[model samples]
Target chain A: MTTKDISRPVCILGLGLIGGSLLRDLHAAGHTVFGYNRSRSGARSAVTEGFDVSAELIPTLERAAEEDALIVLAVPMTAVEELLDDINTHAPTCGFTDVVSVKTAVYDAVKARGMQDRYVGSHPMAGTTESGWGASMTGLFKRAVWVITFDHLMDAEKVSAHWTGIWKDVCQMAAAVGSEVVPARVGPHDAAAARVSHLPHLLAETAAIVGDNGGALSLSLAASSFRDVTRVAGTEPGLVRAMCEGNADALLTALDEALAILQETRDHLATTPPSVEQLADNGYRSRLRYEARTGHGRSQESVSPMLTSSRPVLRMHPGQPNWDKQLIHAETLGARIEVF
Target chain B: MTTKDISRPVCILGLGLIGGSLLRDLHAAGHTVFGYNRSRSGARSAVTEGFDVSAELIPTLERAAEEDALIVLAVPMTAVEELLDDINTHAPTCGFTDVVSVKTAVYDAVKARGMQDRYVGSHPMAGTTESGWGASMTGLFKRAVWVITFDHLMDAEKVSAHWTGIWKDVCQMAAAVGSEVVPARVGPHDAAAARVSHLPHLLAETAAIVGDNGGALSLSLAASSFRDVTRVAGTEPGLVRAMCEGNADALLTALDEALAILQETRDHLATTPPSVEQLADNGYRSRLRYEARTGHGRSQESVSPMLTSSRPVLRMHPGQPNWDKQLIHAETLGARIEVF
Candidate 1:
């Protein structure tokens, strides 16, 4: 396809953090962009902020229906189904996509609506604690992963080429805004997010309970650590709630595993009659192992409990030794090393 | 007993992060500060960094034995017992204090040595991920909390006056270094540290496990959230281990409570069929509560979790309505009123 045939005007639904940011970025990149928000005030704000805003979804879709355009549903996951339904009826005859966190359910929804062929599932893992059109910046998607989920029916070459173009545009924006794009499959994305993103929210909520139990004075003593750990809890509570509710199963699994680790550490502390030095050594070694591995850029594959049990190829590198000597040293240090 | 009679130079043991920072701050405030370290390299580095360094502990104590000086033990808690033994034997003439995290044990150690009258337990709640002489910044203690623990034998009025002078110097340093001074009793400080200091280490350790499992790819995908949560883990492994072992009981308690709350949230997400919006609402509200309570200028009595039972008192202006009405309004509209 020629550049003229490939490039078209873009429609962004729900001009909040994601939508507004995407609109700003796309518009700045010289792409004709139109924004639609359910809230009239939000739409007006977008327009006032120099965006081409449409007061209603249908009219906006109708105006941009031709020109082989792309419509991005940049709302929350809960709003995806309804937005898709509306889009199915009033969507321009072109490709459609979304910026929702979770993808499986939305993919199923789109498939059920018979729009699977032209629909792409993408999630840009970029955000801040703030929300709404006012918080949106022009460079929000710079270098952020614009994940495009592919199915069997999708033309691999066409879809890949189309996404590469979109990513080129998006990556520049992401980099400008200090973000990066990472592509991963749906299940892994959900699981990884549950651990990194959703887990922080849960921890913050739990920390907040300390404030709830201890009065304001107790909370006042809360320093940088408390503030940093619970920073995500201070985010949009509705969004946090939605994430927990949306990715319930994966979060539960992660929680169970995390709690098990904590309980084991607690039990060891309670039951083990070790010297203070010995106890400190245990925590130190464990923490050191974690830190060294993290610093070396090891991935989840090497440390996941599921994978560890099945494949025994994971090993730790000691400070100064050959591979064989390092293996022996690791064994001496009581580390679990497996040769795959 | 007068200020003029107290002519002995203050000896600071261990010139690492806290110790070095304290020496710099104290010297700048016109106090004669001498530093001793177990690491010859650390001592040499301290001397190179313009600190008066003593090579041997006993010889150093012997030199200052005739003068009515103060000894501040700024080493890890694991080393406290050994340091106390040395002080009790050779430094009987000098007044002593310590900057260990857990105070009850250190206080008991001093009491057992029959030096309770001359000893005050102190803990300065200020730090960074960096350690050693290189990481020591002169401004590290500018506005940071320098908690001085006193007992029955210590004259409340005299100690209070002395601490006031010390606080002025330390508080100035804390402000200079961008930290806040928090004053609290020993038990409260430990409990709060358990929540704020100790918990972050554990959380970081846990987050680092993801890197261990995932290898380079997953580690690369690790975003700011993971980095922030795990930043503390990157500190001196030995020091972090010492802290966890020293404050094991309180830390374990805090960890258990944190884990329990996380588990409950996980279970709620799994079993409870709450609307996605409600989940987000809860997260938003929880975060708002935490943010409102954080930051300096708040009294220790105001934000103490022990007194507040986790429910922070939402302060309002005279014209504003009651908190309940405001909460109700927020809940209905999915908004949180966070006024910090």
Candidate 2:
């Protein structure tokens, strides 16, 4: 697709953290971007931040429909359906997308409204503990994953014509802001997100609950580790609630898996220390692979956003010489190695 | 009490990150400090880093005993007993301390060795993902919590005469390096540490296991939230294992509590999204309290290493106008007012 074919005016419906950040990126990419926010303060802040956002949703929708703009439903899960209903009534022919975390729920909403041809579900796997326009930044999505879901939602023709164009446009826009877009089906997208996103939030929430019992001692004793682990619990409560509720089945499954692992660790702790240590070893290996993939602690030049051809292989046998050193080497090489 | 009384030579056993960091701090505080490491490489690294560390353990122990040095056992749980046995044989009368996570096990060891009068259990609540002497820094323990335990092991006389001197000396020494030393009993310290430290590691490990099921899709979807929540899982596997195993009972309790909260959230999500939102709100409130106590996301000048008197107050009821804003305002004020 040519730049002209992809250069449709972008209308973002919620000027929250994700929306505002995307607006900043798209505007920086030289797109004609308009925004609308439910809250007066949010709209005002978006304007103050130099983004052209309308206070009324209908006017933005009307203008988007007139321009056949790419409409992005950047609101929470609970608000997506209601906004989509408004769009369907007011601008029925406009193709649109959403930036909600849970794909299945939004996909279901699109399917129910028979607006699948126009609607795509996208979730940018990026955010900080804080939310709202004030906390939004242009760099928020840089080098982050922007997952696009469409298998069950779009028909083949719409998928090929509209979505193909939309995908390239979105990816190019994201790449301009340093994001990589990955295509995914709704079910798998929700499932993977549950493991990496929703589950962590739930875990953070549960940890915060655990911290409650210890009184002031917990506060005094909590260091960097505690702060890191429970940081997501400081996220916007509405978002957290939407994440847990909208993706209940997947989140529940992920939670079950996590609890099983923790329970096994607890049992091993009761039996032998080495067994629990082995569990920790497994976790370390997983995190090592993740860090290797994401360039978390490494120098930017040495890290890649994608995996390398050299894969680390772990051999489990009796008397592995210098296994720790081997693990460290594999970690530096960004390979997953398992040694037993 | 006095600078003269506190200025004793210090010997740090196991020249790992914590030990090395402490050595740098104490040595900077103008104390004669020596270190010992089982590994030759570790001792060499310490020496290269300008700390006086010996590979041979016995002579260092003898020297420490002669100077009445505050010996810090900074080894992992597995090596604690063996080193304690060596110390009991060589420096039974010299007052010593440990920097292990679990206090009961080491406290029991001290009691068993009849060295309770000389051995105080201390755990500095600070560390990074990296370990060993190479990762050590002068500010590792600065502004960190250093919990000292004595009520369970030390006799009243030893507590007053020896522990008081040791406590003051250690506190002053830690404070000089910007760490705050707090007195705690074995039970409370272990329980709190289990909640804040051990539980987070288990949670991280569990999340890592969950990510394993999804393969690279999990990696693609994992974001800052995943990294933060699972950051502790990236910790040294042996250390993670030691933490979980050493304090199995306390960790088990914490895990149970977390599971209960999570299970309740799952149930709430099934009934009403608002209920789950309430749970998320509770989590946000808890995290806000923690942040207010610690300088996690605030200006350094505004944040205290210790908790402040201004507590956040949350009053949540139906028809409450802008409760979310109210919560944020309350968090800023740090008052615990709940209107639910």
Report iRMS values in order. Answer: 7.7, 5.0
Taking all chains together, the TM-score of candidate 1 against the true structure is 0.77
Cand. 2 TM to true fold: 0.85
Worst 10 residues of 1 chain A by lDDT: A305-314
How does chain A of candidate 1 score by TM-score against the true chain A? 0.73
lDDT of 1 by residue, B41-157 (tens): 888887886778876888877765665457778888778889888887887756777878777778778767776656667677678767776667777654344554434223343
Model 1, position B62: C-alpha lDDT score: 72
| lDDT at residue B298 of model 2 (Cα atoms) | 52
Most TM-score-accurate candidate: 2
Over A233-276, each residue of candidate 1 has an lDDT whose tens digit, in order, gives: 55666777776677777767666766766666677666545123
Model 2 lDDT at residue A148: 59
lDDT of each: 0.59, 0.73
